[model samples]
Target: MNGLFDALERAAGPVTFAPGATLLRGFALEDAAALLAAVDAIAAAAPMRHMVTPGGYTMSVATTSCGELGWTSDAQGYRYAACDPDTGLPWPAMPALFDTLARDAAAQAGFPGFQPDACLINRYAPGARLTLHQDRNERDFGAPIVSVSLGLPATFLFGGIKRTDPTLKLRLAHGDVVVWGGPARLRFHGVLPLAHGTHPVTGAYRINLTFRKAR
Candidate 1:
């Protein structure tokens, strides 16, 4: 975190909606350029592809990943993989900046010393949406999830542990970051369909970087 980002974080003041969940507005603005560049490079190496759920339905979001592990799904199930199913090689190494940003955001949210080994990158074009789901595939639920948003804006759906619980609709804009853990670690969350808009950085799509300790 630089001087500018530190100021931005201070201004945002860690908006908390749950016991262990927080939203930091414009937390990544200072590093957005470099971060987006790294994202482009990672996607170029691994290539983004729509994965099929265990139910055999294809996902609307196009996703790729980086770090020691990558998240994937197919008819088999949703799980973490060491290699990109497409490239048949290890996912691109996590960028140093990504690690730094995740840890800083986690610390800001009151969970210190976070180390993420997996980063799942999702691309949402117009009409793309993610249904509410828990980040339960990880072996350790102790580690928090650090999510950064870029490109277009999207509505984030944050719900309770139960599937039928009411949800809070939070609008997430470019450069925003959300960290959830502890009691909120298992909370169900997702994104609404992205609206049609061109972003200066990502054009007509929204990009989400989800950092997790999948091992």
Candidate 2:
């Protein structure tokens, strides 16, 4: 109990852990609101859509992207592209807040000089979930991943490299940030099915912003 509390306190600012991971809970409620607004603006430009996996399966989560490069998947396999296959247009530019937050969060996590070129925005309604998988589409694994969660809370399943490895379940609420890089960069992770709930701002949905250095 004390150890957990200590970890949380140590994570007060941007916090670094393991080789390729960090967590930042530095943003306030207002910051969260601002980020949500940015997401809305980007979504207005490019609506979220469920993408097809290389295995011919449509992902359960609806996703959109911004920045110089966007992550995508299809029968060809997972990779980053300059344009959205759905619309055949360049992805919306990453919001200034998104870049600022990613850089700040990465620095806090101890990965100084991190500059992400891709930001994947995910929207989840009740029962939506992500299966455990590594984020390997990016060209650089040395850079870490910065993920921010907002709206109704969800359980995050942080697992090891192996698919069968035991996982730690974490309850992540609005404004919570999770960073994983270094040795943990390729670790398996996913979200559990979200329970039905309503948030004052987003109604009955959750939004997650996952920033990466795809270039």
Candidate 1, residue 128: CA error in Å? Answer: 0.1
Model 2 lDDT on a 0 to 1 scale: 0.84
In terms of TM-score, how similar is model 2 to the real structure?
0.90
Best by lDDT: 1
lDDT of 2 by residue, 1-215 (tens): 34544575545555444446555664535588899988888888888998898899998789999999888888999988899888899999998888988888777766789899999999998999999999877889999998999998888888889989977666677888888888898999999999999998888999999999987
**After superposition, candidate 2 runs with Cα above 4 Å error:** 1-20, 26-28
Model 2 steric clash pairs:
14-108, 19-182, 20-180, 20-181, 20-182, 21-180, 21-181, 22-179, 54-74
Q: What global local distance difference test value does model 1 have? A: 0.92
Q: What do the candidate models score in CA lDDT, each in turn? A: 0.92, 0.84
- Clashes (backbone N, CA, C under 3 Å), per candidate, total 0, 9
lDDT of 1 by residue, 142-189 (tens): 999999999999988889999899887777889999999999999999
